[model samples]
Target: MPKNKYSLIRYRVINRCLRERRYVTLQELREACEKALDISPLSDRTIEGDISAMRHDSGLGYFAPIKRDRINRVYYYEDPDYSIDTIPLNQDEIESLVFAAKLLEQFKEIEIFKTFTDSVQKLVDVLNIYRISGMDTVRNFIEFETVESNKGTERLPELINALKSRTVLKLRYKSFTSKKISSHIIHPYHLKEYRNRWFLIGYNEEFKAIRTYGLERIISIDTEESKKFIDIGFDTKKYYENVIGISVIDEEPQNIQIAFSEMQAQYVISQPLHHSQKRLNNIKDKIVFEYFLIPNYEFYAQVLSWGAEVEVLSPKSMRDSIKQYFDSILFKYNH
Candidate 1:
């Protein structure tokens, strides 16, 4: 506020002008400033002073150079190079964006990541222009729901830097099958967002294998300096194109069917059980969703979330396992 009132008003005018117009006459700009900001009187003398202060005083890098023609005179923001390259969201994309931002806000651990954006002010500006504020900012207007897997969690920030710099990771992994802890040196190939959480798919250097490690499951990660990555052979995306649950499959993934009852069909449709889920039919009172995925615990858990509402319809092995899991749970609780 050490800046005088004129200087502050000048910055606002230039910001508004740059935002609204690429080319504007001095007269047009004067009227816009008066109308938008309610200046008591519009005079070229005051406007000229504002323009001068806009360039020298404000750090916004706004420049208003005067243009003259024999028939007319005008003023325009000097640089029209407002690149959309660095822009994160436009006026139309704020709602879903706000929802995602709020979800990340929960992970208090991921506060270390750097985003070159003024997201708060930008979101507020867009919402304000449309007269959206308060709880309506998040409530029902936009939502993010995760279809969590039984896959272990990793420390998110640790993986973020590894992904950013394309570095290898030394991890203390808790293998879900054996419940064994071991050290792994992995050359991270990709970081993907599925169901709200981030997953890293990489080549495990220790086992000479490929594995998908959930950002939340990473018990601890240390940046490995001595082990150098000479080559990363596989493309991250194509590696998981067939396998659904990141099970490190041996055979090609097969199509499977799942049937959900009317009671929990809404929740099934709300958060897709998998990225490839497709509605096969809505037969009278039941809903069926199908997808191609490896038969894994994560897939089993997806169906289990529906409790009595869902039943595996195909792949005999999966159906039997689902029955046994419930039977065990029932036996334990019934006693």
Candidate 2:
């Protein structure tokens, strides 16, 4: 690697000029670096030093096959296909790859990732081709948060195929509140994951409205080949833009303000609850945050998770709802 970031940038700029430009001169290389770096008056000697380092520097590991045409007085790579980017990965880079491959290994059994199983194994074998000791020991040092058995993952491949083919699906689903399993024909639109759980968002043909269903609650899924697929032109980004979690309510987005205790504020600031979260002026000793979102069960659950450390500050309806929850808890304790 280059000692500083600027040297690396200059190397890349020169590399591009050599690869793309015909008969690249020393002046042209200097101009390219100056333009890329947004600095003027880059000396010819500086560009020459950069080229020499790229060609000979063992530390950089480039050893680029750069050659100068004596007759035309131009620089070019001896190997037409040569690029610094194609350089072999260093030990650290190899280790990171090993880490990623190990993580993907955990999901190999899932139908959606079945195709990637052989590819991932081949990558692992390639990484170990040089007999790099301890290449397979990456999992010993790092542990990932993984579900031993994630329910409904088996349906992923079918759901993905349906989405691609724009096929309607008949689903038998059981809600947590009811023991009865209801059947519905849905035009699958989007799949979303929140807190490690998967949700299917689609247009329910029976209800004649867009709905969200927990994939875990889906007892069975069947392709409705006879029925016509509904194309609602669902914009995924716009649909979830004002929502915190999977439950996108019918109500308009509200400016919900919350105050957190100093202890909890640090955690909240480090990891924001929502993309629209913004820090406001502190209220007394508490740190305040504002969000433009349509509050749903997930949002409430998030706020309630903080327990005594959090307080809703605005929108009396939301405050009242949160208060009712706390009051019910207090009532249970009092009883």
Candidate 3:
């Protein structure tokens, strides 16, 4: 085999060994590589050379952070995400990547993705180097509206790190109704984004409930390395599956019916209110839409946003709630 082929084979064997076993001795790696590749067992010197190349080879520079255990003479990758396969992209792959990167760049002004500014720029530079005129045409022609930056975006990286590592975080949070900032130790399970605002859903140690905190209202975050993270077995997808937005209430989904005017119904037909939205009735100028949701604050707020264009027809409780909300607004204006 050619030298390049041999090196590729060696890199593959080494990567496979590292991924399969947390730590592997030189002898163990040689045996595994021999078995997997059906090649002769590599000498100790050859294995050491392979490990060094994986850590420092310019073309395949993985920066693997492979560490050696002095006592047991074993090696393992310190960072699990580090991989040699992510070396470079081919021309077509790079084009597609640039397309996606530019699309995501539309939202780069948002704090959540702002941290990727340097990285995305670097990617753009790489793409630019390999880009053809067609790619540029595709990129320049498309555009997205840049929205205003939301608060607590600077802390996105820290919060994401906490969630990834399952590290307990001490948060200084100020709720919308609260006057003073309160401190709570939380085990962050998931980070969510809704309407440009970022939120952390986690189990609050003091409150003893899985609560959601807007990243904007978060005053500060301190990682509690000393505290062990607790997994409350919260299913984020399942949690928000029945709801429209982040505000989750401890209630079952109720069948919600809303009647909309012909003009508004056309818009709703094209852009659904929720995944659960379905047309229940349409007679003359009125269209009735049905949805199954938890009727959380977000749902009510959404209904309110439609104003006189929408009317809740069923679920007396929710209808009453909507009525009171409008009544209060009217009272404020009337007073």
Candidate 3: segments with Cα more than 4 A from true spot: 1-98, 107-119, 122-136
TM-score of each: 0.55, 0.74, 0.66
Candidate 3 deviation (Cα RMSD):
10.6
Residue pairs with clashing backbones, model 1:
152-217, 153-216, 153-217, 153-218, 154-215, 154-216, 154-217, 154-218
lDDT of 1 by residue, 1-335 (tens): 15666556655765567557766677776787787667756787777767675545434333344333435465554555542223344434566666555665344333443241356446545555553444355624655553343333335556667777878788876755657777778888777766556677888876787777766666778888777873567776667665555555666677888878876777768877667789899777888888886766556666777687777888787788888998999999999
In lDDT terms, how accurate is model 1? 0.65
lDDT comparison, 2 vs 3, better candidate: 2
Q: Per-model C-alpha lDDT, please?
A: 0.65, 0.88, 0.83
Residue-level lDDT of model 3, residues 200-302, one tens digit each, is 9999998899999998899888889999889879998888989988998899998999999999999989998789998988766789999988888888888
User: Per-residue lDDT for 33-65 in model 2, tens only?
Assistant: 999999999999999899899999999989999
Candidate 1 residue spans exceeding 4 A from truth: 1-109, 113-158, 175-181, 193-198, 214-226, 230-232, 243-248, 266-271, 281-284
Local error of candidate 3 at 112, Å? 6.3
Q: List candidate 2 segments past 4 Å from native.
A: 1-87, 114-138
lDDT of 3 at 58: 64
